[model samples]
Target: MTLKRIPYDKPVLFFGNIRDLFLQKVTLHEFMKSYYMRYNNSNHSICGLYVGRLPVYQVMDFNLTKDICNRDFDHFMDRVPLGMQSTDILADLLLLSPGPIWKPTRAMVSPAFSSGKLKAMDVVIQSCGEKMSQHLLKRENPDKEIEMKQLFGIFTLDVLTNCIFGIDSNPWKELNSELIAAFYDCENYSILTHLKMNAAYWFFPENLRRFLKVSVLADDSVYFAANIIRNAREYRLTNNQRRNDFLQLLIDNAAKEEVKKPENRLMDEKHILSQSILFILAGFKTTATLLKFVSYELAVNPEIQNTLRAEIKSVLEKHNNVLNYDTIQEMPYLEMVLLETLRKHPPIPRFDRCCIKDYKVRGIDLVIEKGTMVYFSIIGFHHDPRYFPNPEKFNPLRFQENRNPHGFFVFGSGPRNCIGQKFALIVAKYAMVYILKDFGFFSTNKTQVPVLGKNGNLDILIHPKM
Candidate 1:
C-alpha cells in the first residue's frame, strides 16, 4: 500500500524545511503520539519517514505489531532500523547480531539467564541490595538532593559485576569506582569509539566516522575487563574450581560444545571476553534506568509507594527478612507495581523489525514487502486507552487483573524478546524491596518532572533525568 500524505492543514507531521526537524525533536515519543492522534483512528495505520539515510515505517496497531513480532517471526528476525553493520563494535553480541550468528550466540547465553540460574545467584543479589541500603542509610538527610539515578546505577553495576563477571564494584562507596568510571568513560567517548576500535574493518573510505576514534572499550575499560577475564580464566584453569557465575557458565557450555561437535569450533577466549563485556552493557544501564524510573514514579505517587512498602514489609517478615527468589516471587503487589512502571516508562521505547518476506496483515490484506523496516511504537500501545483505561493514571491494578497480554509489552514479545528480562526484574525488585524497607524515596527539585532524555544518550535504551 502507498503512504497517504495528509494535507499541510493537518496538525500532524508538517515539515517544510530542515528547521522543522528541530521542532519535531523536542520529545520523540510525544511527537509520535501526536501523529498517531492525528492520523491513526483505526486498528492499523502507517507513517513514513527518513531516519538518516534509510526509509522507515511506523506501525501503531498492536495486532500488526504482534503479527510482525510473532506470526511472521522469521521474516522479522533481525532488522533493527539503525542496522547492525557486521564490523560494528557490538557485532558479536546477541543484541546486534542477526540470523544464524544471533541464534547460536543467543543459545549459548540463554541458559545463564534462566530462572533457576537467577535463583542460584540470590546471594549476590541480596548482598548488593544490603550494600545499597547500608550506603543510602548513612546519607539520610532530608534536604540533601540525592541522585537516585546515579545510586541505582551503582546498585545495578554491583549486581551485574558480581553475578555475571564474579567481581564486586561498590560504585556507591566510590562514585568513580573502577568499573563505573570505565563504563561512563566509554559512554562519554562512544562516538569516538567505533572509529578508533574498528575503523579498518568497518568504516567506508570517505566516511566521517573513520575519523572518530571510538573503541568498544576505552583504554582503561579494556585494561580493566581484559585483565579481569584473562585473570579469571587463568584462575579457573589453575584452581580447577567451577563457579556458577555467567563467565563460568559460558566457559562450561563452550567446552561442552567443543566436545559434542568436533567439526565446528566452540567459543574461544575472545568470544567469552566479548560476551562478558556485552553482559555488562546489557545488564547495568537498562536495569539502572528502569529502577530510576520506578523510583521517579514512586516519588510522585505516594499512595502506591506506601502500598509497595507495606507489601515488601509483609513479604520480608514472612521470609525472615531474607530476600530469596521464591519469597520475592510471591510478592504480587510488588510485581504489579514494577509491571505498571514498565508499562508507563519502558526501558526501550521502540523496536524495529525488518520484513524479510512478503506477508499480508490480517483483515486488511495489505502486503508488507520484503526489506521494509517495521517500527513498533511500544510506548504508543502501552499508553493507548483502548487497553489501559485512564492511561495517564499511575495504577498497578491493570497488571493485577491480567488485563491484556498485548497491552503490557514492556520487555517486548515473542521469541526474540529480551532474554535478560527476568534478570532485570529480579534486580529491580530486590533493590526496591531494600529501599522501601529502609528509607523513603521522594523526588527533589533536581529530579526533572516530565523526564526527558539527554541528546547523545538516545538509543533504544531509556535514561531518566539525573
Candidate 2:
C-alpha cells in the first residue's frame, strides 16, 4: 500500500523543523499536534515522516492507536526500544523486554499490583500521607508559598520506598536521604532530553546501541538504587520477613533461587532490582508529576477545585474522618478530577511501538515494513476537539463513567498498558485526599499557572482551613 505524504513545515531531517519548535520549550507531542492540525484537512489518522534516515509515523487516531496497541498486537509486539541501549540491569525490566520475555515477566510482576495487594499497601501510603501532612504542618508558616512538585516528590518517594523496598526513605528521619536524592536524579528527563533519549532508537535500534556501548542512564543513580533493592531483598530473605509489598512478592519466586520445577522460577534479584527501578520511575516522579499537574489545574480553575474539595470532605465524613481504600473509591469527583488531569496532561507525553512484522494497513494496500518505528501522541489524542469537548478546559465530569478507555490512553491501553496503574492511582489518591482534606489552595503572588510547562515553577500557597 501507498502512504500519504505527511505535510511538512520543513524538510525531514533528524527532527526537520520539529526540533526547532521543540527547542522553543514546547513539548514534541504538542508541536506535532499543532503541526498536524494546521497542515492536514483530512480525517485520516496516520502520517509518515522521516527522522534522520528512519521512516516514522505519528499516530494520533484512537482507532489506529487501538489497532497498533491491541487489535493487532502480534504485528507490534515490542515498544520502539527507547532508553534500552545498555545490557545493564534495566534490560531485565518489563519495559524494555520484547514480546518473548515480556509476557512471562509481566505475568510475574502483575500480581504485585493486585487489588488486595494495593489495599494492604494503602495503609502504608496513608501513613506516608500523614507524614507529609505533618511535614506541611511544621512549615514555619503553614500558609507559606511552596513548590508543590518537591513536596509531592517527597510524598511519592515515601510511598514508593515503603511499597517497593519495604523500607522507609522518610526524609523526616534522615535529612540527607540519598534515596530521595536518587529519585530526583532519575527525573532528569525533559522535552529537551527526550530527543537525545529517543535518537538511539530512531537510528541505531536497541541491539545495535547496546553493541555500540550506549547507556540510557547518565550517572550512578540506577546502580545506587539497585544496591538498595539488593540489600532490602537480602535482608527480607534472610529474616524471612513477610511484608505484602513488591520485593516480598518478587522474592517468593526470585530468579536467584534454584527451582527444580520450571514453573517456579519467573524472577530473580536482578528482576526485582529492574522492577524496583521501574517502580522508582513510575511511582516516584511520574506520580508526583501527576499530583503537581492536578494541583496546578485546580489552582488555575477555582470552581473545579472547590467542587473536588466538597467531594473529599463528604467522603471523609462518610468514613468518620478516616481515609482508607473503600472511602477512596467513594470520591467520584476526586476520580473525575484526576482522570481529567490525566487527559489534559498524560504522565508520559507519548508512547511508541516497533512494528515487528510486515503488517498490512487495514484500509490501505501498503505494508508497514518490519522494524519501522511508530509513535502515538497522547497529547494529540487528549487535546483532540472531537473526543474531548472544550479540550483545553478542565472538566472532571467528562470522566465520571470512564467508558471511553480507547479514546483516552492515560495509563495506556491493551496488553502493554502500565502494570502499576492501579498502584500508582491508589497511592496518588491517598496523597491528594490527605492534602486536600486539611488544606485549601490558592495562587501565590509569584506563581504562574502552567498548563503543562515542563519547567514552570507552579508554586501555590497551601493554608489549613480554620
lDDT by candidate, in order shown: 0.69, 0.74
For candidate 1, the 10 contiguous residues with the lowest summed lDDT are 457-466
Q: Write the per-residue lDDT of candidate 2 for residues 1-466, one digit (tens) a residue.
A: 2234443344455554455543445656566567556533465667765654456777747787888888999999898765444637876768878898899888877888888887788678888999988887888877678887788888888888888778887876664577677767774666556566556555554456565544455446788888888888888778877788888778876634466555565576677788778877667767888898888887778888888888889878877898789889898888778888888877687778888998877775557888888877677778777788798888888986663554688777779988887887887788778888888777867688553465578788878853
> For residues 31-79, what per-residue lDDT tens digits would candidate 1 score against the true structure?
5445455445654555555443334567766766777788879888885
TM-score of 1: 0.83
Residue runs of model 1 more than 4 Å from their true location after superposition: 1-38, 81-89, 140-143, 189-227, 452-466
Error of 2 at 212 (Å): 1.9
Could you tell me every candidate's TM-score relative to the true structure?
A: 0.83, 0.91
- Which residue runs does candidate 2 get wrong by more than 4 Å? 1-10, 13-18, 21-26, 36-41, 82-87, 174-176, 189-210, 255-257, 260-266, 403-406, 450-452
Worst 10 residues of 2 by lDDT: 1-10
Top lDDT: which candidate number?
Answer: 2
